[model samples]
Each structure stands twice: as C-alpha cells, then as structure tokens.
Target: MDPFEYLEDLEDDRTKRFIESSNAQVEKRLGQKAKEVFPSLVEKLREERPIQLLVLGNTQAILYYGDETSLEISGRRIKMESRDHVIHSLERVWNSQLVRIGVGIRGSDEGYSLLIDPNGEVVGKIEGLVNQFFYQEGKLCYVKEYRREKSPDGVEPPVERIFCGDEMFPFYPGRGEWLSVTAEEKTTALLKGRGWSEATLYVGEWPELREEDSGKISSVHIVRGRVYYLKGNDVMMDGKRLFSSNHPVEDMKVNEKFVVLNVIKDYRSSLSAFTPSGEPLWEYRGEHVYSFDLMGEDVYALETSFTTSHSLLRIRDGKPYPLRVGRREEMEVKDVYVKGDVLLHGFLLTRGKPKGVIVYGYGGFSVPVLPFSSAIFQELVKRGYSVLVTNLRGGSENGEEWHRQGMLRNKLNVFRDFSTFLSLVKSLGGRTVAMGGSNGGLLVGATMNMYPDLVDCGIIGYPVLDMLKFHKFLAGMYWTFEYGNPEGDDRDFLLSYSPYHNLKEGLPPTFVYTGLNDDRVHPMHALKYTAKSRSLGNDVMLLVNLRSGHNASTPESRAEEMAYVMAFIEECVAHSSSSLHTFTIKK
Candidate 1:
C-alpha cells in the first residue's frame, strides 16, 4: 500500500466536482457583482469626501495630496523641518488628544539621535547612537546602540547586553540579571533582582537546519522558575538536558503543572508534555500538529490538512474532542486564537460572485489577521466594501500539506480557490478588489494576468513578478520549498503562471508598489511589470517609495501608503463614462 493512497482515495468525485463548479461560479459572479457594487462604493467615496495626504520626509519635508503638492504648513496642514544635517530618518505621528511627532535624525559628527514633541514643538532630545525608540507608559524609551570592533570578516562582533528599565547595560556584571547577546556568549551569572533569580535559567545556541529558520533563537520559555531554550535539537532546561535528538523542537509552552513541547521531524510533528522534574506527562503523534495555544487547563491542538482539513481539537480530561464553531461546508476555519468564547477565528469561505467581495490571501509564513490586512480591510469595509479572506492552499493554515498544495506545480490551486471565493461573493451581491503582498503579491499578479476579468481592481505590493529570474537574487534562493527549484521540471509550471511572462493586452487596472531599499523582493519586479503593462496598453500605476523596505515599517510612511491606496481605489470604483488615462512607464 502506498503512503499517499489514502489522500488519493479521499479526493473523491464530490470534492473534484465541487471545485470545478466553484471555479465557474466565481467567473460569472465576479463579472456581475463588480459591475453592480463598484458604483455604490465609488459614490460613497465621492459623497463622504475625505482629504488624502501623502507625507514623505527625507532631506526635505514633502507633502503630496492628489495633484496639489506643498511644503509649507498652513491652517489645517502640519509641517516639521529637521534641524540636523542628517536626512529625516524616521517619522511617526501619534494622533491622540494632541498629535505627537517622533523623529530620528542622524548627524555626521553627533551620530544618531531622536527628538520628540507635540505638533512639532521640541519636547526632548536624546543624544546617542540609537536605531529606534518607542513611547512606553508616558515616557519615551530608546533602543540604545553600542559600537563594537568588527570581526576579521568585517562582521560586527557580538557583545553581552542587559535591559534594566530604560537603561541598557552593555556589560552588566550583576547576578541573575543578564542576557546572552552573542551566539558564543553564555550567561556567566544570574543576578539577584525582581522575580526568581535562583531558578535554573539555561541559555545556548540553536543551529537551524532548514532554510526557513530565522537563524534566531529556536525556542524560549520559562517553566515555573526555570528557563528552557532549544539549542539545535537539544532542550536545555535550567542547564540540564531534557530532550536531545536530531529532530527539532519547533514550539514549547509551559504552565505551573507541565511543559508542552511540539517536536518536528520532516513532515510529522508530535506533542509531548512533561513535569519540571523531567517526568513524562503525555505524548501524541500526528501530521502537522504544529501550532497550539493554551486556554486555562485545556490545550487547543490544530491539525494540518492531511486526512482532515484544518481541524481544531480540544485536549481536556486527557482526551481530544473535535471542536466545531461553524459548518465545514459553509466555511473552513483555518485558525482559531481564543480569548475566551470570542475566538479570533480566521477562515475561508466560497460563495457565488455578485457580492463585490474582495478575496484576500496572505504572503510569507502565513500570519492571519495581520495588522496591515486588518487595518486596510476595516477601512475598506467602513467605506462600503464587503471583504473575504481566502486561507488559500499555500499558506500555513492547513500545516505543511496545505502549504505544499499551493506551491510549485500545484500553486495554481490557490488562484482557483480565490476565484471560487470571489464567485461565491458575487452570487451574494459583492465585488472584489484582490490584494496581496510579497509572495502573495505574486499570487495576485498571476491571478490578474490569468483571470483578467475576475477582479475589478488588483493591488500587488512588492510582488515577485518574474518567477524565471527570482532565484537570481539573494533572498530568492530561500523560496525553493514554496516555489520549487525553477531549474527542475517545476520551471515549466512556473513559466506557465509567472505574472511577468503572462502579461497580455487586456486586464483590470492594476496598482503596483515597492520600495527602493527592499532587500527582500527587488524593486525591479515592479519596474519591469510597469513597463510591460504600459507596452501592452493596460492601465497601471507604479508607486515606488524612494526609501523604505518591503512594507513601510514606519507609521507615517505606512499611513501615507494606505492613504494612496484608498485614493486609488476611490478613483477606480467611481462610475464614469470616460476612461482614465494610462500612466506612462518611467524608464
């Protein structure tokens, strides 16, 4: 008997036919729904008019609003000019009772310093080489920087550091109050301070074998008074070996009674709980039992899609019960983060298209209800847009298999699933504005190129456009698991769907944005797409941030980007007899 025969048998005629019917429904629904709801959304934008502003600060303060660009601050406008010779490095405006602006300025002679105030009025200036700062409790705390001699290879050598209140001690000798700052650095002493200082605290290095490993600490959790860290495949709790194996301990959680660890080896993951004294509590083996969150005495275990779709199981009274919040037919719950009965349930639903619903999927390692996605969708919904999130095949919702289904040759399933979702939305009277970023941006771009009439408007952010050329870059090599090695037979499938290769004469108006400093997806993706779209006479706009990376990390820049997106959507959805002029490709 083959190992995958079970999966093949489960893919019955019912499932296959359902998927096919869903795809057809999506196409018909999207066309009708987009025509219906677009006018209403556009009218709402026109009537409930709000001023859109783009604030970009570098060497000079720049404010761009529609066609009106200005530098001066007048009655309703706000402005601040940097006094330091350095470029305006960071800017954040906290709108509360009073608008607070925090700015970081770097000077050639003085190094980097931060200034904060209300309405541009100087509140206080902190002088030191600092990378960033945050407002905590009512005071500002700076992330202090320290200079260190470079290694022989020019890498900055690591130094031990400690954070005690607002001050950062680079070499604090205090007992029970030390943090290992370097890979080789060990906690020499446990400084006596707050909490339990005499508790067994262990620290060690964790060498990640997989490409996806962030190269940071593998695991960190404090059980009782003891701290346990996973270094490579070994679990060191209070400087004692608790579990040592070649298989990695993916995740761990602790409570007063027991410590639960999720161990991963290849495709399978097992959950085990143990006492603080190393006594085994319980162990269970399953495929993709990766993520778990505890609520009181019960632990919720989410199984990855294998024989079952992503299912939530409650482990209580030493037994597992399948928890049902909603019907699997109507909606598939991808993830559930419980804060009491009000579960922050992440889900995917397929409905017929006529409902003008924007179907959204995620990018990277798949984090649902992300700050960006939530905020943007909330604003859109407030402006009269129905939205749906598609926990598409490639994401982490169903564990490794779910993720694998949407990668390489099978990657088209994600787009098909999204299309089905849109159709379902349209059947219920909704239109869609498909949006995604980074790898998900590739998903959006490919969808728009392949299914030109499926979406009314597409937002592709820092997208990986050229699949054929993606692996030529630095970070692109890490995507082999998700995208497959392009040099292999998978290259044929990638070429078939690569957005850069599939761009044609007719498509919906597409908006592309990226950053010049994007170390992740090179800006050339946006640049080349813009050129091709223009060459094909498609209406497209490319907004390139002069200085930023991936998603704009700073608050002000992100706000400005969001404002731009809102304005663009408003214009696109507006009912007009005249077609908008296509933007010229900037060489």
Candidate 2:
C-alpha cells in the first residue's frame, strides 16, 4: 500500500496511527539520551529577554516578560488587548481612549479589524476580512483582502476604502495592501500594486484609484499642509518632482515641514532631509542601515554588525548618538566582514574546532536577518554548535533591488546565495545542517534538493513543500507574484524547485515538522513529505505539536517544539559517533 495515500486523508485514523508509529520509532532510537537532553533544551529556550511591542499610535510600548505583559511606563497591561489571534497592525486615537487593531485569524490569512475603547472593551469589529489600515487623527481608512466571485482568477485582489465613519467596506473588489490614507475632505491613498512592485499616488472614493498624479510613484505621504511622494528616485512635493537621486530612495518619513529620505546604492546608505518646498537641509552617508523608526522626528536607528550584536543609535538633525537601553554584553565574530553582496556572519561557541554546524537562512517573503531576541541561535550556540547566519538576496537586506533580484524567475539567485554561504562554512571544516522555517523552509528545502552535498541534515518547520498545490492554501494566492502562479503556463518553472516534487532518495536525515492547528500551511505538507521520504527508504522524522499555529503561540509550545528538534539532532550526531556535547533532560 502507498503510505503517502493517507495524505489525502488528513487526521484520519490510519494517518494518525502512522504518524504516531513513526514518532515512536524515533523515540526508541533516541532512548535514554533523548530523556537526558530535552529539559536543557527547554530550559535554554525558557530564558526570558526584554520583549517590547510598540504601539506607535500613542507612543506607548508593552513589555512582555515571563507570563505577563506590562505597560512600559506604568507597568500595567491593558486587559482586553490580549487575544488568541496575533496582532498584525495596530493604532490608537490621539486621545488615547480608543484603539484599532488588526488580528490574524485561525485557518486563514484574512483577519479582523476591531475597535477597542479605553474601557477595555471591543466596541466594534469587522471580522475575518480586514488586512491593513491607516489612521490619521481620529479617522480610519483600511484595505481589505476578500474573495470576489466576479474575479476570473478565483482569487479577488485587495482594495482600499474608508470606514464611512463606522467601518470600511470589506468585500470591495480591488488589489494592493501596501497603502496609506490621509484624512482630508477628499481622501487620498498611496497604493502599491502586484506584490508591491509598482506604487501609485491616488485619491478617490468607493472603488477607483485616481492615477492622474501617479507617474511611477514609489511612495506618498501628507505632512502639514503639503504632500510628499517618491517617483522613481526623485522626491516629489505636491505634483512637482523635487529632489532627484542617482540611486534609489529606500525609505521616506515626513512630518510637519520636513521630510527625510533614506537613499542608497550598492549597499551604502545616505539619509537626507528636505524642506516642504524640497530644499535639501542636511545629509549623512555611511554604512548600510538596517532600518529606523521615526519617533516624532527623532530617529531610532537599528544597525546589525557582522558579529551577532545590535547597536541602536538615535539620530537628530543628522547627528547620531548611542542609544542606551537594556543593552548588556556583546558577542564578537572574529572575522567581521562582507564578501560581495552576501553577508557571511559566523559565531563559534565551542573552544576547539566545532563538531556540528548550522547554516541558518530565511530568504523568502523579503524578511531581513536581524541580531535581536534570537532564541534559536542562543539555544544552538549554547549547545556547542558553530552557527553561520547569512543575509542573502531575496530579503530587504540591501532594499528592493536585492529583493527583486531573487524573486520570480530570478529566485535561483536566492538559492545560489545560500549555496555560496554554505560553501564558505564548509571551507571552515564542519558538516552543516541547513535549517529554516516557513518561507525559509522553502529556501533550505530547494537548496538541499538541488545540492544534496551542501548539507548533512535538514530541518523545515511549517514549510510550503508542494508549490504546485500551494495556491490552494491560506493566503497562497497573494504570494503568487513572489513564487509565480503554479497553475499557469509557468507551472514547469515552479516544478523545477518544488521541494516535494524534486526530492531524491538517499538524502540526509531530515526533520520535517508542523502543527495540527497550522492554518497557514496545510498539515498535509509535512505528512506527505515524510511519507514519501520513508517510502524511498530515507532517514526522516515527522514531529507534530498539537494546538499550535504558525510560529507557535506561546513559549511553552516553542520550547516543546525546540526540545524535540534538539533531541533529534543529538540522536543524529550520536549515530554518527561524533558526540561532542551532552545535556540533562528533566523527568
């Protein structure tokens, strides 16, 4: 019988039993050693750090520690803010009495936008449709991603609308999520189209995007009584092009009479300010900036070095100063440098030559690598494994050009970047376990599938393996512009790297895991992948944690998942008979 045939029957008795049996086999093989190491893994993950989530609406931040969340100022958490769904976007009225929040719901990429009063009550809601929103003063405008049956593509794109004093229209037919609305007599919005590649400056009502003033616009903002936007590399105020740059404008921030533009080319960044009329006020050019938050005209610059350490700086009037906040000791990477465009960052925690190595990557969805609150790296490093983290293309490491260079048909560039980083680690003499989760899982999966010699073992969590059936999953349609629509004429292109379809027998011992409650990725991915690997007589394990969503909801759940993977790694090293470290697991 085909073991993978059960994949068509998710949560069925046969499939459940099969998964249980496979897990039990792994347990028996690990035996006492697994019992001895699980706790330390959990304990290491249990260590608390200063976690803060900012509510830019009221300039208030919430600190999450242990099982508690506290207001940074008064040390009291507003009761009704906590929920089962993850907070995606949030804002509060200037009065501080009203709050608006967008939440990611279960089993779908679509979520709800809710309005909460100062009395800690959810007074109003638009459930399971609202994706993002923009607020100015007390007025609210939002963008919705809903299925419109009229769309020939089966997936209706997203559209922006005002709340009409009560709520925004959810079922409106449109496309685009990267948008910002201004609260004027005639509302205006900056709309980004199709994977946010093209931007438009628009002003309209109901369903139309006014494009008269939008000529290859990149971004838009309204400040004071004036309007500011970017068209290509030129900064435009009102309808006239003002400050033009030879390089691309990466980011823009406007407030009152001044606008600050972060422009860059070839991995170097320069920040410059302009008056409302576009007169250049000041400019500073330096090393690549990771990102900066505009805190009332003051800048909190986030910088990441080759070492796994972060330094926050505050910039005012082009002058930068060290920001002292909750910083302790720092870790140094001996050879702190960059080769070509790939950032080769390594940390060796053990004294002698490392026995195990982990090459970490997350190149998809344009998520950048940062050196902050990385529990995964901390746990692995403390376990005596050398780790290499790469800031490859396909991420916003060097901005949009870098992202575009690795997307669509050019996605092979991302895979190539990972191969280059892995080759760098191999020269240092260690067998690497290529690792990633979600989109990163796709990264490691595709690379390992194409170049099996690059890694000894692979770990993929909540991954999208079957790119062919990917669009059928939650919010999968939206990502088509990134990976290409698998059902179209380009289906063959996707088949070239869909990990499940490209898997070969005799690959490394792979750990494929996901959650039962994973609404984002279909649970059948890990199930089917593991089944096929087993059928091909490959060494693979499927780990499932119950009642968890993508990224896992709570710390205990995270620790449980981490302990299982760590235990599996220990077993793999033990079987190879090159055990360099050991840990105790509690009863």
Candidate 3:
C-alpha cells in the first residue's frame, strides 16, 4: 500500500541515487549562499559560554567553563576524548563515584555510560544504559530493551529486562514496557508502561506490581525512604496523594527535605516546592526553568526568557538569586493572541521592522513552546527576519486540558491553531515561512497542506509524514499515544490529515531535510514526502545529511546544514509574492 516504501532501504542503490539527485538539485539552487554563510555560522556556534552542568555541593559542581571538550568538577578539569560521544547527563553515585551518561553523536549509534571514581579513572562502561541506571550499594541497576521484529500492520512493543551489574534478569520477571527506574540503596522505584497511554508504578527491591496508581504517570523518584511520583496533576508520595496543580507537572526533582516541580501554564513555566508530607513550601514563577538540580538542600537552576540566554540561579527562601547573570539581546518579543477570546498565545520576536516573517510552532507531545534565546534565531532577526514562536494546543502550555484539546480525535485543533498564527502573520502583509522539526515538522507539513495560501514556504525537518505506516519505523511506535494508532479505528483520523497522503499541486515551496543516520524520526518520511511533492509539480527541495542524526553533529557540520536552511529561507522569501493574502479572523 505504500508507494515509496523502497526509500526506507537506506543501502539500496536506487535509494542512494534518489537522495543524491534530490540533494544535488537543492545544492545547485542554494549551495552558493550556504557556502558564504558557513564560516560565520560556525564562529557563532563555537562561541564560548559558561554552561552549568549540575550542582554538587555548596560551591562544587560539574560544568563546562567556556570549553566544549572538557568538564570542570569544582576546579579540576577532565577532558573527554571520544569523538563519537558527548556527555548527555551526570549523576553522582555514593560519595566518590560519578556516572557520565554519554550519547552517540549519530542517532544510529547506541551510546554507553561511564562510571568514574575519585581518581578520574574510568571504572566501567555500560553500553545501551545511560541515565536509566541507578547505583544501589556497590552495584549498578539498569533496564535494557530488546527490540522485536516489526509487524506488517501493528506496532511491536520492545521487551525490556532489568540487569544488575553482571547478573542478568535478577530483579523483575518476564517482559514489559519499562519506562524508567530509580533506586535509593536497596529500594528501587520502577515505571512500566501499559501501552502508550498509561504506566504503572512498582517500588522495592522486588517490586510488587499494583494496578491502582497506574494511570497517566509522568515521573517517579525514590527519595528519603519514600516513593514519590507525579500522577496526572497530583503529586503522590508512597501511594498517598500530595497537593494537586492547576497545570501539568512537566518535570520533578527531589532531595532529602523537599520535592521540586516544574509546572507549565499560560506559555510560561513555574517551579514550586513541597514537603514530603505534601506541605507547600514556595513557588517561583515568570522565567522558564531550563533545568534544575539539588545539592543537599540547595537548588541550582538554569533559567531564561525569550530575549535572554540561560543564567545560573540559586533558589533559597522561595526566591531566585542569580549566581551568573544571562546576557539580554536586542530582540523584542510581543505576546500576541491568535484565537478568539484570546485563547491561544504566540510570541513575535523582532529586532526592527522585518522584510519577512518566520512562523515556527510545535504543538504536540505535551511539550510547551517556551521563551528562550537562540543564537540562530538571533542572527536571523538581525538579518531583518521576524520570528513568531507559537504555543499551540497539544502542548502543556495551557495545561493537560489544553493538551487534550489537540490530541487523538482533537489533533485538528493543533493544525487549526497553527493556521490561526499563519493567517495572522499573512494578514500583517509579508512573506511567511512556516518552520518546525520532528513533531513540529508534522505540524507545519499538515497545516501547509490544509492552508497553502497562508504560507509562502515551509521547512519540515525529520518529520513524520507517513502517518499510516509511521509505527513500523524506528521509535515511531512510541508516538502512538499522542497520535492515534493508524492500524485500528484511528486510521481514518490519521489518514485525513496525513501530510504525505494529502499532497496536492498547489503547495507552497517546501524544504524537507532529514539525517541519514537519524534513528528516531525515520528519513523515509522526508524522502517519500519530497518525492511525492516533486512528482505533483510542487517546489520541494530535499537534503539528507549522512553524518548527523536526530540531534546535532559537530559544530562544523551543524553550521553547514544551518547555512543551507538559511539560504533556502532567504531564497523563498525573495521569491514570495507581494500580493496580500488575507483571511477573516474569527475573533
């Protein structure tokens, strides 16, 4: 039933020729501009800034001090020499050992975690286990999933098992969907999924399975001899309900005395603290908390806003005291209401009156589009581009209810939300390029198909376009929760808005790119969509980078790819029609 299924064969001669030819055409169009911009972009990317990793003690912690190759612990610096791996996270085990979670630069490469002792010696390296592992006594407890053969119609779930040091399957029996596991000495807290919609909580060395307290669990942690978790909107401790929040709890961190929660509502994130007994401590709102870590009872965080870079802050007495101040750029952001009754929020960032507008959105997976500084966007703004970042539905921007309004059968609400912003930008009279990646790519792809007249061009990167067969690809099965399963009754709904399936001749100029090494969002989505769009006489450019993955590669490769993207944007805006295209505002 899939016409371009051959594109999935990454090693096929025909597939290689197809991608090579498409990439050649794209280079012929925008390669010169990209080449000119590459050097400056690389310089911008390599700019040194103090990146705070984690807080260890009062003054001691792990961080990158204006250097990319080395990490400083307190004052001691250790250089990582692995060309293929980078430190994704750091966890302190016991008092003398640290675990550095290293993820592969390429998406296809399964990375390993390193256990380093006090002498800076490499203690152990465990492959396929990163942050999921926990230190218990002197042993390491972790979970690993063994992927099964893909089904022709349905998505196959991976069989997961728990491994402790050298012992195989010592703790949990049988196979299940293990999401995450945390341990405190002998006690372990495990989260196992019951399909994509719900996850059950299991605690103790030999965790007893309980069906109750199992629905919609976001996170779990075992701290201070108690199992603490966030279920729905309420925080639960040892199966006892703590206080509930008006917004969805995005992330949670715990120490000995208190539990900290990062909650999102109204396009902003707030950090709140509560005691183990469910007593409210303090709440810090306004700025977005990019990340947070606890050292003893002290809370250190990286927080920022739309026009500011991330700043290091220490929270005490319910206040954020800046340890390192962030730099504020010249970019001015205006919060604009896009829908009727001022229901939806979108922020327009511009340095001055712009020549063109870039409308960016990612309205899925309960992920909010918060305000944050980006070097790339800042440069684009300086070049007379107005960027509009929207907090559409299907995200936790408004709350769980807001997310519910844009998922499953309500997925159309996400596209409708995006269309509203595009219409607003188009009404203001300028070229509007819709841009997004991953889930956001799906957003732009679907909206452009439905409302091609509203956008001048689109940039869809590593997208999921083939909704009907998405589950059969790598990691696509996990997204069935947000996007309904296409194999069953959900097929009709998925097919209706599926970007590749809905392609027509009137689409705007589109730039579709994917990493050849990307294991998360399959490259087939981009390739097939580009092939079909070009076949229909639409101007769709395709680029497949072999060295990179779902994430970024080396700064040089990243800058090169970004230069191409910028060139494409410039070209599209230059060719955009000057005629005004307006739509009636529902409000």
112-212, model 2: which lDDT tens digit per residue? 66666544456677765553354543555555444332223343433334354465434333443344444333344545555645545665543444664
Candidate 3 residues 291-366, lDDT tens each?
7787676678877787776677888857878887655678877777766423777877887667788899998877
lDDT of 2 at 191: 53
RMSD of candidate 3 to the truth, in angstroms, is: 3.7
Q: How much does each candidate deviate from the true structure in C-alpha RMSD?
A: 17.9, 6.3, 3.7
Q: What is the C-alpha lDDT of each candidate?
A: 0.48, 0.61, 0.74
lDDT for residue 80 in candidate 2, whole number 0-100: 25
Ranking by lDDT: 3, 2, 1
Clashes of 1: 30
Cα lDDT of model 1 by residue, 95-155, tens digit: 2112222233211212344343333444555553343333333444333322333322332
In candidate 3, position 561 carries an lDDT of 74
- What does candidate 3 score on TM? 0.90
